[model samples]
Target: MPAFDPCYTLIVLAGGQGSRMGGCDKGMLTLGQQTFAELLVHRLRCSAAAFNPGYGPVLISANRNQQDYGRIGAQVCADLRPDFQGPLAGLEAALSRASPDLPAVIVPCDMPLLPDNLPAGLLRSVMADQRSVAVLHDGHRRQHLCLALWPQSALFSIRQRLDENQRSVAGWLAGQLVADVTFSEESVGALPFACNINRTSDLAQLPG
Candidate 1:
């Protein structure tokens, strides 16, 4: 993906309580020696500087452990919804805080192996159609909610869907013009970008 306009924000969702991981904060959990959240923030910052230089900003939607991640230097925000609605709610809250004219690229903190080229690919896909939401696909299934580029203009509809008690990311995305950009499994190798570390057993699946 070639460079284009540089007005995009990368929103990292790190607010989950990690119930499956024995209630530990997945973002702060150690993948090896370093915390997963710290690794993600480092990689994202590097990617942004390399691929999307001059990008608007990078924001993180954090909850109780906001200070834990504040050291990363990205803007951190508390969940806007009363309960932990889900990743969509986090995105909605982050979107609400973003500039209306700027686009946003979002990813989850649990995805430790997110593709380095993901931001550029999402931007390319979304730019193909102004009204379309760009997402990542692992060939077989769309990694629909994992990595996405969303326009701030969609905030109203997103909030409306949330108000209606709709929490499905794929479902909400379906209502919009959406496009899937495939990432070759070979390119990512054994590191699965979509492999979320939710439980202790899930950690075993990570490359040692």
Candidate 2:
């Protein structure tokens, strides 16, 4: 394994309009005792630690509730435009604030149960394959938002996509050379950690 890179940045995507949750900020929604953003911070810290002693700062991409998200103990950044363009826009904003030479792990705030080995797993694939992007695959489908990492060099591609009004993340990934890092059921547990809470009904299904 390559020496752990401490410059890897973590970008927690919380900038969506939350149209499905009755227009509420999903990141602020309570998952048991903690808010989604809070849960992600706690989990991500553990994941990063397992990979390296010192990683780069966590950046929360949020459009509303900036101050509240900041209270979660992470640097907060808003999208370049305020119309809630989607996660890609938030990703672009976060990338701009991060160091251009290093890689960044992008995740949705709603998927707080991300595997503890996420950072290390993504980095390993990225280095081994020498690809600009890598994401977790849950044996069946690509967990694009739960865990995805890319070198800042791909920021230009993201910008070009946004300029063309192409907001589909899958479409963007399809255009790039991507590595799929598959996590077995035993490794991530019986319940996939990539699962996300998208609607109020989904809350009732959250693992306790």
Candidate 3:
């Protein structure tokens, strides 16, 4: 087995309008008292500290709300694409900022209930296989485009796809040697991290 490398980057995509939540900023919505984005950053930071201590870095891709997210200590960046294309745009922007040699684990801002051991699992899988990309699968279907481990070699292809206006993450991964780390639903349960608060009704279901 290949020894795990502890020098990977974590990038969180947080630039969405949250139109499904009645035009609210999904990241700013409060789950308990703290905003969703704040809680996510805290969880990610904790997860990184515990699993990949002294790793590359943790960055957040913010849109017009860069200042608002900057207060949370994440290296804030703006999408270079003309419009808010989607999470892929954010990932591309993050790739440009990160060290090309270091791998990156990307997560979405709305998945507050992300499994605690995600980083470790992803690292293990990536090290075992020299694949350029991998993501999490829950047996049924893929999770949001939230979880992805990308290598530097992918930057060129990603940028080329963007230039061709192909913003679908699934399509991008289909062209790569992608691996899926499967998780049992029983182990994860119906947590908010996996459950995205897209609509008002979804937010209402959050644990009080």
Candidate 2 lDDT for residue 192: 55
TM-scores of the models, in the order given: 0.87, 0.87, 0.86
How would the candidate models be sorted by lDDT, starting from the highest? 2, 1, 3
Per-residue lDDT of candidate 1, residues 1-208 (tens digit): 6555455677888887788877777778776777777777666553445555455577788886888788766778888898889878888888877766666778888888876677777777766666778878877788755555555657877899999999888899889877888888742344466777777877776764
Between the candidate structures 2 and 3, which one is better when assessed by TM-score? 2
Residue 119 Cα positional deviation in candidate 2, in Å, after optimal superposition: 1.3
| Residue clash pairs of candidate 1 | none
How far off is residue 24 in model 3, in Å? 2.2
For model 3, the run of ten residues with the poorest summed lDDT: 184-193
Clashes in each model (backbone N, CA, C under 3 Å)?
Answer: 0, 0, 1
Better of 1 and 3 by TM-score: 1
Tell me the lDDT of model 1 at 203.
Answer: 76
The lDDT values for all models are 0.74, 0.77, 0.72
Report how far off residue 67 is in candidate 3 (Å).
1.3
Q: Give the runs in model 2 whose Cα sits over 4 Å from its true position.
A: 1-7, 46-55, 186-191
lDDT of 3: 0.72
Strongest candidate by lDDT: 2
